[model samples]
Target: MLQHIKMYGAIVLAMIFWAFSFIWTKIAIESFQPVTLVTLRLVIAVLLLYAYAKATKKFQYIKRADLKWFVLLAFFEPYMYYMGETYSLTMLNPTLVAVIVATIPLFAPLFAFLFLKEKISPVNILGIVVSLLGVMMVIYEPQVGVETGFWGIILVFVAVFSAVFYAITLRKISSHYKTVNIILYQSIIGLFFFVPTFFITDYATITDIKITYKSLEALLMLAIFASVLAFVLFAGVVRKIGIAKTNVFVNLIPVFTAVFSWLLLGQQLGFNQWIGIVVVVSGLFVSQLSRKRKISEKIEEITQVTEY
Candidate 1:
């Protein structure tokens, strides 16, 4: 029971940190370019994660054979995913961005089944349907002259796709490497990718620009809370309870993002948005619980048969 509770808490905290990312990226992007912000965040995060890994003596196991996969993971995640999201947030509202990014759970299973040949249970499909309903509710409201740009929405969709791809890729790569090594190498590779892009895109003008304390704080928060801590907790939970169970926690991200935006940014979500949150949460719980229950019952039946 206590172990289950800890798992649940870890999932919840992970979602909260992810939600906070929406808020932080919104602020930091106000002053910096998308790739520039990403570059800076990756640079700081790589340094920090390396230090943590070395101080704890966790950095020595990355084999040369695994380097290619790490670089590939970095390409999908921090480079493509972060760049897409950072650009989208600059163009869209935080809540809208959250809603779009939250669609990953709905889409990831499909990609996983297609690419990784991972099974998607019927319950998971139902959860995806319900979660999609919730996402639609959050974004659907008639307004005069409310223009959601097509390009921004497209960017967020791509971000979601990138994340889905990364999760599927992670399944294959995690088998060959420790999560720490995977993340450590990915961050380093991502930083490598980010540097040249930053130079070509924003470095020349960055010297003349003023860096606001608010932006610095937001970027730092993105590095520490969203990037470092969230990934660590997620890796730990995956190690403990397995990734199948750990994934359902992602459904809570949109909920926490909405709540935080309301409290901190004074953003108001409409009645329909609240309903969407409920639907999404319900679907996720039902989907995960149903699968677990079925597995437990199968185990019990096996035990009974053996006893007989």
Candidate 2:
């Protein structure tokens, strides 16, 4: 019972951290370009993860056969995912960004089954339709049309697709590698992707960066709490209780993002939008409903391998 308390607390904290990540990235981007901010966050997170892994003696040498898989993982995640998510924040509010990004797990399995031949239950399909309807509710209004720019939504979907692709790559990685080790290599390798893009896209604007205290604080919070700590916490819960139970907590991210956006960022949603939040979260919970043999096995493979 005590262990359950700890794990539940840890996962809840992880959700809070991830929820705030959208807010933090919004603030941090004020001082840094999207890619620049992501690159720096990755640098800080990689260093901290490496240090922690070393201190705990949990580091593992990468297997050569798995080398390409790690590269691909970084490409999908810290590279494409961050780029999509961060750039979208430039155009969209945190709550909106959170809603779209939250759709990842809901839709990843559909993509995986479509692309990778992974199996899923009929219920998963129904849940995805419900989730998409909820997402549309959050995104559109009868009078105003879509709530944000088309490109912004498209970018967030890029993050979503990257995560979907990462789910495929995740299976190839050797399970013996510690989670920290996997993240370490991912961050390290992800930098290679980000650094070049940063130089090309945002480096010229470096001189224009404002470097305010709030931005720096937000950046550090993103690195320590969002990128590193939340991931470890979520991963621990996944190992302890398995993905089915632990993943349900991820639905809390949008709710927390909405609350924090109101409390901290002063963003508000319309009544229907709030309803959409509930609906989407409900759909996420609905997505997890699985009883048959196929869903029980495939679900363990369908969801996230890591978080922000």
Each candidate: what lDDT?
Answer: 0.71, 0.82
Q: Give the per-residue lDDT digits (tens) of candidate 2, residues 91-180.
A: 888887898888787776676577768686777777788778878878764443354566788999999888777766676764558768
Q: Quick one: best lDDT, which candidate? A: 2
- List ranges where model 2 is wrong by over 4 Å: 1-3, 141-148, 292-305
Q: What are the per-residue Cα lDDT tens digits for candidate 1 across 1-308?
A: 99888877876787788888899898888787888888888788788888878886877666777677767778877778888888888777687788777656556556656765667778778977887787677666555124555677778888877776666556555656555666667778888888888898888888766679998999999888787887777767767876556656676677778888889888787898789878877766655554443322222221111100
Candidate 1 yields a Cα-based lDDT of 0.71
lDDT for model 2: 0.82
The C-alpha stretches of model 1 lying farther than 4 A from their native spots are: 1-11, 117-120, 141-147, 237-249, 292-308
Candidate 2 Cα deviation (angstroms), residue 230: 0.9
The clash numbers for all candidates, in the given order, read 0, 0
> Model 1: how far is 65 from its true place, Å?
2.6
**Candidate 2, 198: how far from true, in Å?**
1.3
